[model samples]
Target: MDTQATSAPAADVTSLPPVEVDDAEAALVEHYPRLVRIAYLTLSARLGRHRRVLLAHRVAQRSLPRGRRVPEVVEAGTDPAYAVVRLATLRGALARADRVDGWRRWARSAGNAVPVPPRVIGLRLFPRAGGSEELALDRALARLDAPARAAFALRGVEGLDEESTARLLASAGVAAPRRAVRDAAMSGVNASLLVSGEFDPCVLQARPTDLVRRRQHVRAGVGAALAVVVAAALLGVPGSDGGTEASGPPGSAQAALAQALDPASLLRADATAWQRADRLDFASWPARGDRTGDQALLGRALSAWGRPGASVHVSATAGTPSTPPAAPPRLLFAGDVDGAAIVLLYDGVRLVRYAEPLDGGSGTALDFARVDGALGASASAVVLARSDGNASYLTAPWISGVSLRDLLSPSAAPQAIHRAADGVTDPVPSAQAATDANCGTAGATWPAIRLTPRAGVPGLAPFVLTDLGDLAPAHLTYATGRGAVPAEATSADATAAWAHSACRLASVRGEGVRTVNTWAFADQPLPDGAGTAQWLCTRADDWSGDDHVLVQFLPPGSAPDTPAAVSASARSTAACGPLQPGVLSGVLWKARDGRWYLLGAGSPEVASLTATGGPRSTSPTRTLVVPARQTTQAELTGRLTTGGTLDALK
Candidate 1:
């Protein structure tokens, strides 16, 4: 608020003469820009590491009345020095590391006291020495984001005052508090020394003076961890309501944003509209983004849809907002895979859009408001199985057809829309036909999209719903609207072919309206030609309505246990070693135990637990039969198909 005539040169502000006017209207200013700059540098240094630290440094007048250097900077006479004199001890530890990531991973693991998420570097205090000292710093300096580390190294490691530090690093508004700066330096120095194999500088070693603070190492990163176990394994980190996120980083709101959605992995391949998540607070379920019941499931699928190599970009601003924007809402995110970038937009949480690259690689922008309006018709409502959308997405009073999970059938590879009794003719009619009450597929008004693109598939042109209008493109960053596409069961021939294959596809549930009429139990007791059988009284067609199946599995030479317990985890683990080499290695199954178990072991990077498989896969044996068991329930209780499997890389 310097109320005087503005001057472009930094010299003018830096050379202000001492002048004060207490008058009410006497042109006045507080130099908030400089102060903010001070704060940004202070904090950025505090939250050390060279990654995209959100600090922005702006040149300012250096007329600080109380002139003194802040604690984070390294003084020339500091012990264990060099450019950063107070850290010679840190040099010793670096010699031992084989791979930086291994050490880093251990340092940031959940079990560690203060989860130092590899970013937020904290405090450091160096011992004094004569004029020249060698500060053996944690050379892993390569890891710290350039902005953050520079801010910290200059201020904390270079002995510059906050303003000088701010100017030095170039981003100003994000300065951290003096104490926090000290903490960050200490954290950095501690980590450096520990990793360097010196005196584990973090242990406080009696402090030898009135140096830093009292108890606490919240975000236990290696830097913090060194501070912790080195000094009581610093405790729990304060997360976003959990940990103190570096008092906001050192860049402009725009820069932090750029940093946040900086990478491609965060977005869909070349998506103009990518998705972004400001933070992962949802895993903790903060009250603001409530999204109850099915809404929650929708939220989960949408959020995880982005793939590392996805062309569409995605991002989100994690704030105090209550509910997230509706589907097809344009968003921004950490780039598709790298880190965070600012330009991209995405539908952050619910879906991943795949689009052909725009020329020069700007993603195709979607008109989100228009699209949101279209999806609006089915918000929290049940959608008919055959709702229409070809050119433009169909909008009307309806129920969302199905969960994304049900979209993909082997025959229905890209989609999970099961064959409705009436085919694509009347979704509402088919859903209503089941209960006979015509209550409209219960919430099918618009919320339940029985079929949408698989959580991460991509494309823009209309393919399915020939009955709808063409979807108009939105100007928003991401795909704005979705035109209705026909479910694979567009006709009887297609539906029948897919359904027949799904039905005949063995003991493991494949696709379609299939119910378990009976299950042929393998590995369990078998009498004559009959193996232990867990038969479902329900037939494949029972999937349409009140159909239920009976299931009983018996071991090959043993008597059937009155009740059996199968753990998807155990089965998955066994399948890796025990079930492999068999022809059925690739068969997919929804275990009676409730876990969706897949038959084959995939790539080494992913293939391990048998009970747990990727969301989709193929089955080797399709024909399976067993003596029918007489039971009322379609599936046993406590049964779950390791329902939440990781999405495949493709």
Candidate 2:
């Protein structure tokens, strides 16, 4: 080692001449790999190995000056050009690793900005793996701060003495050069290990990133770009507002709106299409709203549907897609309802409704719901207007008559409700109209729209639909006895069964419920010779393919319309639906004689029942009765005849 030149004073170091750009370039080309290795070691290890390798190369290549002469001063004991480029590379690496403060740091933290090294798409570069000794040395060096790493790399990789390392660290903008040298000494790594190929950036391993994911990202990016361009073009088109035309030449907006707003362009069904149609969905519905002929109103609706403004409030039920329609949709209704101009459109898969203030003010609202496979009862009605705790519906053409029935009053006769010439019914109190105090009360009335289908329509039945704060109301059905299939709540037994289960509908309000079915699963004689009790399971299926299962126990002598005691409830399960019709549940009951018993029951398929934990009991039958204290707890399971074990619903 040239100790004399290495130990030269700081004053002599500051007096060295600047190197020419050509000389600096030549030096960098000759010693590029060594410089990159130094930079790679000096960077913060938080950057992964691949990024560190590429960043090291980037910083080393950027070390050369743009001017004819490099202004950086040279250090003693090193080639003047090499020393200049080396110092630049060290400063660049340290700057990258330094902590950023203020707005730039905040921006990076918020993901609004990122200061990363240049990246090459679909390619990753990393240094080659090395032996255990080299790995241990690399890890130890990584534990030091950036400035200390630079000091250590200078001493170990470049064979520089401590004095020269300290001087170079200070020139690289390190505040505590002597302390950094001391910190580097704490790593205790053998200097020979630092020269291994493991730390060499030039000796790299190149691999391709996820090619399949890359293709997907590229396709998605292209699609998003195209959507943005189309939206921009639509917004820029002039004279597309109603019938007003711009002063300049006609643009694409006029042509687009002309095609979209033309009443002849909309797909409309014949007045009696439902009578002979193959499917009883929205496709068979005829245009019936009074304002269907108003071209201006139709144009506004079509424009908003295609490209809604920022002022428009858009909402969709779960699993409903909110994308713009690909072609002109069928017109179902367009009229003024309540205080808003409403438009209903269907695109075979989704129902889209648009509403704006009738007085031409703001507050436009758009709603969407999935009604893809609707038939018979499910397609009986669509909500026309909802405001002030009341809602109205547009009954289907096949619906011969509409009546209102209070679900809680099973014996009360159905009251006639009037409908306009266009098939829109008068506003009635919605389920949400019930106050919190009376929502689940026995005396509270739950009004449901009862639609009587036209005669001679096979498989068509009267549907009891109730509003749940969604664009489409949920259909309510009932099952009379064990193993009975669910159907419309039209029969005497079915109507009485729904009277007990109607109050439980409050649990699924505003959940985008599509259908609610009440099944009388079991009727077991109570313990202590008490009168028989009924077990019912009510399942609410939502539009998102998720179902909520609730088991209720109606004890003997309960009121006709009294709410049943909830035994067990579960969401997103197949316990009560057709997929797994068998259900097992248990509840602790207190008899009139002041005795406590653990009462358990299962569907007929459950061959045996077992109760364990706090109160132990087993029964070969589907029902289990065991004595227990009031505060006792237990786990129940049932074994089906098919050899499948079912856990108690919770």
Candidate 3:
């Protein structure tokens, strides 16, 4: 048996000499399992048990120094070697937990470049199960944040006192070590519970993962490999087209390929097509980019659309197919913008944007979005370039005016924004701006592009579009009253209603959103003649036909931009949409007289409302009011006029 892997003796450093690389290695080797356990407990529990196990071992293995170098001396009364390694382990786990945002997440999504521990096929590994006390400890640790978990693990498992744990946490770059210690103490778990064998990752339970399903998957993989081998062999034959052609006859493939690459075959609309066209969409867009006449660039882009190279980064919105177009695609734009050569193409169903570095570098990017039935407001703009948290748009040809509007400040006049001759607007702050700031605060502003179509364009309304980190910006629409149909949100009432709900858009950013409709479903009167309140529902629909709905309550006398309290929210449901057409939600409100009340409201279809739990009350109408406390936790339900029961939106 390997003693280093199986056992770790307690370190005695009362009279140890100055530490070196070899000393660190010795300490790491003897205490490797303990260090792994510490990292496992410190890492975020959201990563799941298998990944946490592997990541903990990987972090522990990398904690040792690479070469013979002088190690930094830690404070007295502790082994410098163990202290250095422990700090490194804690820092690595914390960094991993915090890397789920910003560019790191983008890089991982685009290229899968985020480093991860090796994964085992058809096997799962987890720490051996302990008794109820150990399970309670695990649950308690999971409830705390990463920093607090680190504090607890160090103080408990490592047998360190509060001062040592704080010092170690500080050395590991924790900003508030004392606060983290306090949070850990408040977890209501005894520190001794953390030292149990249940938390020991080195003693793990291994199990095979779905053996029957794995066998089926293996057979399918083998069949796929065989098919690839046969296709390669056929392509190697002389006088063959090298598998470049579509699945058709010999000459038809050549004809299709020629048409796809030929610029003259592209459907270019006349500059004044919108004035005479019956349908107002991309079909009326005239090719306007500077490089539209560059045949070589267009050819390259066309070829890339059919078959992108291995280095090309290709992404598509949900429900958007990445396959090649069946016919010659229309060229919308092809120009050099912000150091990148961009080409935009539209087949009747999809909008494809292909971009490559202007310097001829390897960072080529291709994006696809579904615009099959886009018309009017939905087809008003497409994102031309997004860099440094700002986005520029290529507006439709009929758009004669462009301006920036802050949805959170409806009273503010629309600010004029610069638009180029080619119709590309100047860079405006993207949705990322709202997410980067403290949401719902006064500083958070959501900038929306307001487009004004030329006069005499029937059925076209001036509308606003906001970038949601996609090739196409999501259209914003609104409705004023209950059971009203949503329309272009350009009226003052719509703008004012959106002001209280705009900050909620941050939740749906970067989610392939296509359109967001805000509807004021109900207005309720407050108790004791305080004032009236408004209940609004904002539904964000994604490209995949799923919707995210949020119901908010706007109290009387709130600031114009004050974010409304979220009463309820749900995903992938039609609770607040035309399908369901009914929504019920409640909020605990404090009146001006220092009395708390439970306020509930439902859509027009709701005949009665009821409040349970902390406050029990019922109303024969669509609104409910009851006296309550600040800490009151209540459940709201409604009975529809059609005799069906409804629960509050979750």
Candidate 4:
């Protein structure tokens, strides 16, 4: 368990599988070391800095063994680093760092408690160079002070961001206010002398056997840097000859690093493809890690294990049946969900652990599955997402009809449930495919509808809805769209907002704020235009007084007769008309059977209707590829039809 392996990509194994999934994995295993070697070489050749020396050490150790391979590194020119940050395991790596917590923690423990490797100890990855030798950059970079070296390297060599540079520097105890210290670093720093003088001493100390090679490598590196920098200052780097190294001069080594690592570099690399000075050479995306397979198994299993409607929601005060006579009532369980992961709690049959995807993949090895409740024989069953910020409750058994909104106050108590994938707000769709026809895109998977209600809204707070597919991602709209939502029927005072899946009140300031008071009731301020309340007739919908609330659209695809008012029966008509007695009074919630049940109690005519259309085919939805044993397509489709919109987020 080396520290490098503990929390890096190699250990994180799940995600929306990329194209050629198996090939990607195999390629990574086969070519990762070569990729690392190339990066180390290119960077060392230019800046000759060893700031990621520790990282280099880890990289070398992580190489695949004989007959095995590592994933190839995906070269992202400037912004390649940006994609890496999305990965949980990178832990502030200069490049793509996805979910690596498990590996990181494991690496730390392994490095600390385990014995060192035997002779020829290996990470086992092969370098890409024709010679196939590990790039000896560690020796090349060690000559300079950590800050000056990191500044020059991150900015010019590795091409990392200032913030990332600062982070790495800070971690290494080298403070330079991000890239600010670069100004003071470029003197005739004399790369050759430093490598020989400094690297010579360090190599002898760490790997005495490699002295001859270290000496040769360090000399070649320094000599190269001398040529590049001196040439830049004299003839000047191709881009500029503006002023001092401190000023905006392209010749400066510092400027080069900033240019190299800028997250946008890859995005703009093509603009300079033909130019030697500006062209970049690397793959423009995040690379796959070694543990991707495992990540998937664990992610999907926990989601099923913690069936929101099936599991019972219990409060801490709600003790279980099994508490010993003297002990506080606690619960436990050990039954498996048909070979799917089962988290048991002890109400002596009382509390149970509910699982959710932890590292973004599927698995049932009993590894990475988390659940709420106490530990014991129940330990295997209960994986606690600790309450870190405000005291929050973990889902004990995922009680029926309860939306997470009622259970969580995110901004206020974010850290409470420490182990959920992302958080309570990130809705994981049910495996059920409730409807009849193929509801989503032509073959692409779209997830179960996920609707989320606002956190503190009055009556509607407990239930808000949206197809998560509607998340507003800038460049990926087509890929992200779940549906299109029109504005909600707004009263003069309240600014109502309706996305296809959810609706909320956007409080406005000043005079307009005085209009829709939540207290009073009025009918048809649009007086002449009246028959009954319609979700469509925004004008006649609101009551006359300060509080002018009306039935907005019933369900996204419901009929005109399906009055906005919950009381009016689900109107199904071609004209899209309002049904009689169009006045629904409250919020929506799901029932035990999975059908979306409304809560407005006032009118008898109000009825739950099965609307014809599904979620607007706009916002991209999330889809699950459930393994045959865990759930059948029929079972999943059945779970989806229960709600008005098939929204699981709510």
In candidate 1, stretches whose alpha carbon ends up further than 4 angstroms from where it belongs are 1-16, 19-178, 188-650
Q: TM-score each candidate.
A: 0.19, 0.62, 0.62, 0.18
RMSD for each model, in Å, please?
Answer: 26.1, 15.9, 13.2, 32.4
How well does candidate 2 match the true structure in TM-score terms?
Answer: 0.62
Question: What are the lDDT scores of the predictions, listed in order?
Answer: 0.24, 0.77, 0.77, 0.25
lDDT of 1 at 27: 16
On residues 1-650, what C-alpha lDDT tens digit does candidate 1 reach at each position? 11211212123322333332221112112333322222222322223212212222111111222222122323223211111111111111112111245557566554557533322234323212111001223232333443444445445333355555444333223344343344445544433222221211221211121112111112112222221222211111111233233443333432323223223223222211122322211111111111112233333223322111233343311111112222233322211111111121233222222222213355532111111111211111111112222111211112224322111121233334433321121222221111112212333211112333323323321122211111211110000011111123333332222222222212222121211212221222223443442211112221111122222222233221112222121111111121111111122234344444322222222222222212322222222222222321111111113322221111
lDDT (0-100) at residue 239 of candidate 2? 34
Better of 3 and 4 by lDDT: 3
Which lDDT tens digits does candidate 3 get at residues 444-529?
A: 78889889998978988789888887888999999865564688888998898888888888888777787899889899999888
lDDT of 4: 0.25
The residue pairs in collision within model 3 are: none
**Could you give candidate 4's per-residue lDDT for residues 518-573 as a string of tens digits?**
21112211112222221322211110011213334333333311223322222111
lDDT, model 3: 0.77
What C-alpha lDDT, on a 0 to 100 scale, does residue 219 get in candidate 2? 49
Q: Higher TM-score: candidate 2 or 4?
A: 2
Pairs of colliding residues, candidate 2: none
Q: How many backbone clashes does candidate 1 have?
A: 230
lDDT of 1: 0.24
Candidate 1, run of 10 with poorest lDDT: 475-484
